[model samples]
Target: MSSVKKVLEIQRETIPYLYEFKDSKLTPFSSSIEEYKGQKQAYVVYSFNKPETEQGSGSRLLYTRIYPNESAVRTTGDFNTELGEKKENFTLNEIKWSVYEINGTPNIHLKGEKDGIVYEIVTQEVSLREVKELLATFISN
Candidate 1:
């Protein structure tokens, strides 16, 4: 099993949020976690193994929301159809999330709702420099 690293932990309102990072065995990529303005909102972007394809490579942008003393609902789906011609090289499967395009950039949107309280998280593209900076800040904090 791959070792997991706890990068950051913070509380938003009553719910506590945690961020973890791990390396992908199938690719040279790593996933990063980020939080939004509201408490209980965060997202994780990672490259996952796609056993259905010969290359065994795929990407997953997951958004999650945590509720206070309640269970959260999660929705996920594939966006390859919406990706149009860009869907050639990759086989999008087991998609249980949604994607939205804003200002020409595609973002994965994940939401959790329970007892009338909702938490929203968005997934963004990860970069090596950004990850280094984030880890440095996390370590310093």
Candidate 2:
């Protein structure tokens, strides 16, 4: 049996958020956890893997929303290089974004599988503040 490297990273600031279960096998090219408008958000990636194309996740299709405060959610039957491509309207106040989008950066990745399979529990939003507040709760518990 093989053990996967899972590390939970906490971004410190006025509002903090945590990134849990990050893969260790992959090497990051540019990675950092910082604060955005009083919200702690992370911009992380590996030279070997990224949020979109790290493992076996295949395909990113584009779509648009027809509502205010609404965005497109990327759906994956399983997680790998990507959770999927999820675009949000930001106006919805219901559109989720990060755990995917780190900082002001966008992720582009190749798709596949690793050690059977891996999945990410994603919660996204337009505001880093909202993302921070949300994940802060995800970890404190």
Candidate 3:
């Protein structure tokens, strides 16, 4: 089964809401639902530059993760607490979001929660504005 179909199946069975890229330029190539410490997480990976690989590469990839519940999402309120107020926070339609840099790394993490489920979008190449646009797209969904 294709990644998109897998995501749809997972969404239909468990998640109430999920985010996806609607742009023609982004192509979803991989997806899966994982469990760790009894928590469920659904994720889809979209690639912008190429397709199909023996080993996946993170460059130019857009990754989105969906957690089944608030407690399942560890970074839910990290910006206000663990992050020590050094992150960028924003909101849209009652959904609160935060973008924080991974110390000593070039990657940025953007996370948010809605209706008890948490959603996250992470990439190494996309700009903050582009990330926000992606977040807005997710919110609209």
TM-scores across all candidates? 0.26, 0.26, 0.68
Which lDDT tens digits does candidate 2 get at residues 1-141?
Answer: 111112222322221222222234233333343333433333333222235634532222111111111222234332233434443322212223333443333442221112222112322212444333433322211
lDDT (CA) per prediction: 0.33, 0.28, 0.64
Worst 10 residues of 3 by lDDT: 76-85
Per model, state how many residue pairs clash: 5, 27, 0
- Measured over all alpha carbons after superposition, the RMSD of each candidate to the real structure, in angstroms, is 13.3, 15.0, 5.0
Off by over 4 Å in 2: 1-16, 49-141
Candidate 3 per-residue lDDT over residues 1-141, each given as its tens digit: 865776667755765466566676566767777666766777777776554563555467667777755444444332222222336888965667888775655556777777777777666576677666655555434
Cα displacement (Å) at residue 103, model 3: 1.5
lDDT of 1 by residue, 1-141 (tens): 332123223222224433223334223232233334443533333343434564422543333333432434333443222331221121111112223333345553333333444433344453323333332322111
* Candidate number with greatest lDDT: 3
